[model samples]
Target: MMREILINLPIESHEVPNLRELVGWDGRHSDYPTLFERCNFWAGLRVEKNNELIAFGYVAGMGLQHGYMEDIIVHPQYQKKGIGQSLVKKLLQESERVGLEIVTLTYDSKHASFYNESGFKPCSGGLWRKKD
Candidate 1:
C-alpha cells in the first residue's frame, strides 16, 4: 500500500499519544492539546490503505518569519524510507510559502547528516533556557 502525506490539517485530539510514541519522547506533558493546537503547522504521514497516522512533525514560531521545527519522527517500521525527509521538505515548503525568512530545528548530533542533507546549517546562537 502506498503512503500519503497530509499537511496543515488539524490533528484529532485522540491520536496525540500515538503521535508522541513515534519518537518515544517526553510523555509527561499531559496537556498535549494546549501545545499541539497552538502550532502553526502540522504534517502527518498516513497509510493510504487505512488513513492511519504513521508519522508526525510540526513547527512553532507564531507562524511568522521564524519557525522552530520539533517532534519530527517516523514509525520504527517506517524509518529509512525517506518519510521523515518528505515531511521536513513539506514543512519547509509550506513555511516558505507563508514568507517565512528562516526555519530551524534541533536534532541529535547523530542526525547531523540528515539535517545537512535537508539544507540546514549549524549556527551558534543563544540557547532557550527560560520562559519569556
Candidate 2:
C-alpha cells in the first residue's frame, strides 16, 4: 500500500540526521535548514501505521521553467520496497502542477532503470543542463 505523504512542511528534528546517517555523511549540515525552507517543492513519506518518516525528496528551482530534483533519501530499512520511486513520482507531479517546462535529476547509474521507468531520459535527449 502507498504510505501517507506530507508536503511542503518544515524539516523536523530527526529528518536531516536521519538522511545523513542513511547515506553515511558526517557532520551537522547547518545549511540544510535554509535549503529545506527554500525548496520549490518537497515531501516526506510517512509509515501509515505510526506516521514515521521513512523517505523524502525535494526539488529546488526558480519556479518558472524548470526544477532540479535533489537529496532523495530512503531509509536503509525501507530500500527496495518501491518507496523511493513513489517519492520521486510525487516530486515530478508537483513540478508539473507548478507548470514547470522541464524537470531534471541526477542519480547513481545503479538506479538508472528506476528513473527510466519514472519518466526520465538521458540528458542527451535535449531536456536538461545548466544554462549557458
Candidate 3:
C-alpha cells in the first residue's frame, strides 16, 4: 500500500532547514529570505504517519509560457515508492490549471528514465551558465 502525502497550507520558515537536509543531491541551500522571495512558488510535501516531512517538490512560474519545476526530492528512505510521481502529477495538474504552455525541469542523467516515464521529453536546446 502507498502512504498518503499531505500538502499543508501556510508552509513556514522552520521547514527550510529540513528541506535542505533531506535533499540527497548537491544544491544551494536556500535561506529564509530567498524562500520568501520565491513564495509565489508552490511546494508539495510528503508527510509521514507522524507528520514528518519526507519528500517535497517546488513549482514556479505559473501561467507563464515556461513554467519550471525544481527541487523535486524524496527522502532516501521513502524513494522508489511513487511519492515523487504523485508529486509531479499534482504539479502538472496545477500547471495546466494556470494556463502554462509548457512545464520544464532539469535533472541528472541517472534520473532521465524516471522523468521520461513521467511524460517529460528530452530536449537538446538550451544555454546554461552558473554564476560564481
Candidate 4:
C-alpha cells in the first residue's frame, strides 16, 4: 500500500517536539525558540496520516521580493519519495505570489543533486553562512 505524505506548513511551537523525534535534531529543541523568534517567518512540515510529521522546511527574511529557503528535511524513511520536490514547488509558488525575485539556498555537495533536480542552480558568485 502506498502511504500518504502531506506537507503541512507553518506548524506551531507545540508541534516542534514531534518534529524533533522525526528528524532527531537535538539542537532544534534548544535553538528553535530563539531561531523562530528572530526569523518570524512561516515554517512548513509534511504530515502522514494527517498526524505524524514526515518532513519539514522553512523560509526566512523579510525581503519577500528576494527570500531564502532556510531549512528542508525529510525523515530518513521518506527520502527519495517525491515528498521533498512537492514541498519545494509549493515554497517557490508561495514566494512567487508575493513577487519574490529569487529563492536561494546553499546545499551540501552531497545533497546538491536533489536541489538541482528541483530546478536550482549553483550561484557562480555568492556567499552564504549561518550566523551564530
Work out the TM-score per prediction: 0.86, 0.81, 0.78, 0.72
lDDT of 2 by residue, 25-132 (tens): 652566567777687978887766766667878889899998889877887878888888888888888888889988888877897998998889977533467999
Clash pairs (backbone) in predicted model 2: none
lDDT for residue 75 in candidate 4, whole number 0-100: 69
TM-score of 4: 0.72
TM-score order of candidates, best first? Answer: 1, 2, 3, 4
What TM-score does candidate 3 get on C-alpha atoms? Answer: 0.78
Judge candidate 2 against the unseen true structure and give its global Cα lDDT, from 0 to 1. Answer: 0.77
Q: Which stretches of candidate 1 lie over 4 Å from their true place?
A: 129-132
Tens digits of per-residue lDDT for model 4 on 50-74? 5556666656678557778866777
Give candidate 4's whole-model lDDT.
0.66
Q: In terms of lDDT, which candidate is stronger, 2 or 4? A: 2
* Cα-based lDDT at residue 38, candidate 1: 85
**Which candidate has the top score in TM-score?**
1
lDDT of 1 by residue, 48-73 (tens): 78777777888888776898998887
- True lDDT of residue 126, candidate 4: 77
Those runs of model 3 whose alpha carbons end farther than 4 Å from true positions after fitting are 1-8, 26-30, 36-40
How close to the true structure is residue 21 of candidate 1, measured as C-alpha lDDT?
62
Which 10-residue span in candidate 4 carries the lowest summed lDDT? 1-10
**Model 3 residue 56 lDDT score:** 65
lDDT (Cα, 0-100) at 65 in candidate 3: 74
